[model samples]
Target: MIRHLVLFKLNEGVSRDEERVRAGVRAFQALEGEIPELSFWECAWNITDRPIAYDFAVNSAVADTDALKRYLEHPAHQAAAAQWREFATWVIADYEF
Candidate 1:
């Protein structure tokens, strides 16, 4: 299996409470059962107040690299990513397990 992790940092002056941000969060939260390649999915806001912590996180798993690629290229995933692009920057890591 492959693990796909993402951490998002809100842009300066952006607030999590904004309607756009909330919608983006909802989009991501909706991805679990929408994508067939996703075997697991978990997303949420950060609870800690530490400076180095990201504002949001997504932890997901797929069967293999091909499945991971399909997940990345899926239209729903693309739309959600585009939504985040307007208000935040993110980092991702993927590894086989």
Candidate 2:
């Protein structure tokens, strides 16, 4: 199995905090149902006091590295990511088990 985690920080005035967080949560949650290789999905809004923290985030579980790769390259994901880039600072990590 593989875990793919991503965090995003929206640029100043680029997005409404609440709405952007909600959309990120919904988009990740929907991936499990929409993407065949997505076994699990979770998203959250960061509220910690840490200065370097991201604003919106997603954690996803996949069956394997291949699945993870596919998810990253998926058209839907690409489109969403493009939109995210317009308003975000991004970070990503992948783990295997």
Candidate 3:
């Protein structure tokens, strides 16, 4: 399996309360069972207020690199990513397990 993790950081002057941000987060949360290539999915808002803490996170797993690619290219995922791109930046890491 492959673990695909992401940490989100709100852009300068952007607040988590903004409609765009909320919608984006919702979109991500809604993908748990929507994508066939995803074996696991979790999207969440951060509870910590520390400067080093990211504003949101996505922890997901896939069957392999090919499945991960499909998940990344899926239209739903692309749309959700587009929404997030409007208000935040993100970092991602992938590893086999």
lDDT of each prediction vs. the true structure? 0.97, 0.76, 0.94
- Each model's number of backbone clashes? 0, 0, 0
lDDT score of model 2?
0.76
Q: In candidate 1, how many Å is residue 96 off?
A: 1.1
Query: In model 2, which range of ten residues has the least summed lDDT?
Result: 16-25
The list of candidate 1 runs beyond 4 A from truth reads: none
**Which should have the higher TM-score, number 2 or number 3?**
3
Residues 14-50 of candidate 1 have per-residue lDDT tens digits of 9999999999999999997999999999999999999
Q: TM-score of every model?
A: 0.98, 0.81, 0.97
Q: Give Cα distance to truth, residue 73, candidate 1, Å.
A: 0.4
C-alpha RMSD in Å of predicted model 1 compared with the true structure: 0.5
Q: What lDDT score goes with residue 44 in model 3?
A: 91
Superposed on all Cα atoms, the candidates' RMSDs to the truth, in angstroms, are 0.5, 2.2, 0.6
Q: Which residue pairs show collisions in model 3?
A: none
Stretches of candidate 2 off by over 4 Å are 18-26
Model 1, position 58, has a per-residue lDDT of 98
Q: Is candidate 1 or candidate 3 better by lDDT?
A: 1
lDDT of 2 at 39: 89
What are the per-residue Cα lDDT tens digits for candidate 2 across 1-66? 998889888887775455754565566566667878788887777778588877878888999988
Question: Which model, 1 or 2, shows the larger TM-score?
Answer: 1
The collision pairs in model 1 are none
